[model samples]
Target: MNRRRFLQSSAALSLLTAADFAPWQAISAFARELDDFVRGPAVKDHPLRQVSKHVWMIFSPDGFPTPENQGMMCNITFVDTAEGLVVVDSGTSVQIGEMAIRQIRKAFNKPVIAIINTHYHGDHWLGNHAYVDAYGDSLPLYAHPGTIQAIQGVQGNMWRTLMEQWTNQATIGTRVVPPRLPLKNGDELKFGDVTLRMHHFGVVHTPYDLCVEVLEDGVTLIGDVAMDHRIANMDDGSYLGTFKAYDSLEKMGSRIWLPGHGEPGAGVLKWNRRLFEGIYQPCEQAIKDGLALEETKARVLKDPRVSSQARDTKGFETNIGKYVSLAYLEAEAAGF
Candidate 1:
């Protein structure tokens, strides 16, 4: 069977199975477990540690993964300057955001003057309300035009979903907050001697993906655009576009990459681009061969490149299936 038929059949089978199984109950149970794990410990508030004279990073622990999967962790960074502090991405929950803020306060007496949201994802921007509630009108939030629309368009559904997946109803009732400011591309934010430049990388991870480059500090917070090749999520439109944007990042080198998840690394742009290419080439070949979706997914999963990454082998098949489905749609639209 070809790719299209396989997907159609698989989708039909999935729907039938879903109708018979109580997946929501399983999901609810897993969500509870995740909430317990995420809320188990509060990371001690540490003062801002300076990376450069003008740049300081407030490191906070990762947030719980969305209920969709396990082992994924989210992170946010804060850059401090003479004028005030500029947070890179607000965390998933208000408590996480507040904890990050407290750490910033421990290092610098200045208030948080600006927030740059890398994208519209709930994990990155949902904590904006926390800063707004604390600072009132003193804080200015920035994000790409597309990102702003995503946050406003969802009407907080994404936030609610994340809260439900990561935390229980009680926690959700307590800590969830909304975004305050909407930003555009090419917006330059100044804080004393430090200047944070925001640039939209067209449509990559999302239509509104933005990268923040600190000129003086030589650090780029490249949001989810730079993944660790561990089960890359392509549910968002433009998976290939993400590859192109990452290519641009590779050309525009930075000293260190502050990613939204995983450990901080150097030369992330190049590394991510290579990973994207590795995934893209095989999928493209499978498309050319007219393989069915399941065949393509199985082929991709068995490839040495897929196994090289530290991800569950079984999970790779599922991730590849998703990528193949989205990539097929993209290729079709482009008249491939």
Candidate 2:
């Protein structure tokens, strides 16, 4: 059989196996079986904008996934190296990656030789499917060890499920493709003429957010550790740790900081830092004053730093309270 036939057979077999498991699984499998000939909906192609000499980005204006956006929420970056193209954060799904591939081919002639997943966030890496399809499966997928482990564990499937729900099944049919290679802090990878230096400082966005610096370009792709206008999800993050990261990252002196969300610019880190401080500082003070979480939330809202950016920040009204609450709890724990 040809490669295409083999892949089709494997897919059909997987669906058949799932059909034997449970009532829900059987129903899902039956639905997939009915649509076995159809592929997942392809995401509309977003134009790639060049950030620096070697880096280009497919910017997603939406910060959160919705049925309309179809999980195109995170920024997908590409580094054009002499060796081949290096993908930073593949994207949210197979369809998204497929769209990115079209965009990349339109702008650059180089093939994608490697993929770097910034973290285990589904939005950041689930699009590994399209890359693996376009390039061979041997394409090296790199991530911090903790990120690799998390994606290979429950976080991988959990994110796939979450994206499907968030996009109203638009991201359905995306497989969990975890990064196979583990990178550590201070590791330097030379992709032909361009050099990539990895930076991981304890816990910021997640326990293993990896920032890739394009040394020659003087650009660092800081993952979800910092977002432009959107407040980062602090469910597995630390305000103190994030502050420390900002301090260290600033010292790195990269002229341009590219975030996983939002446009890349010189002011990216400072913008996120000021907004985070607005949310976290008040919570820290509230803990000192023995104030309640509700009071802390009010204080955070009243802070000029946060309030000024409220209208511009996506999901600020809906997410700030939760971010403030997490910061409050972290502050309370730190006081002990």
Q: Where in model 1 is the C-alpha error above 4 Å?
A: 1-53, 58-72, 174-182, 312-318, 332-335
lDDT per residue as tens, model 2, 1-336: 533346556765776687554466665665555433435577988999999999999999999999999999999999999999999999999999999999989888789999999999899999998888789889999999899999999999999889988987788778788999999999999988999999998889898999999999899999898889887898999999999999999999999999998888899989999999998889889998989998888899999998898999988888887888889998999989
Q: Which candidate wins on TM-score? A: 2
The TM-score obtained by model 2 is 0.90
**Which pairs clash (backbone N, Cα, C closer than 3 Å) in model 1?**
2-292, 3-292, 3-293
198 Cα displacement, candidate 1 (Å) = 1.2
TM-score of each: 0.76, 0.90
Candidate 1 local lDDT, residue 279: 60
Off by over 4 Å in 2: 1-38
What's model 2's lDDT at 89? 97
Candidate 1, 106-140: lDDT as tens digits = 66788888788887777777667668878985677
Model 2 is weakest, by summed lDDT over 10 consecutive residues, at 30-39
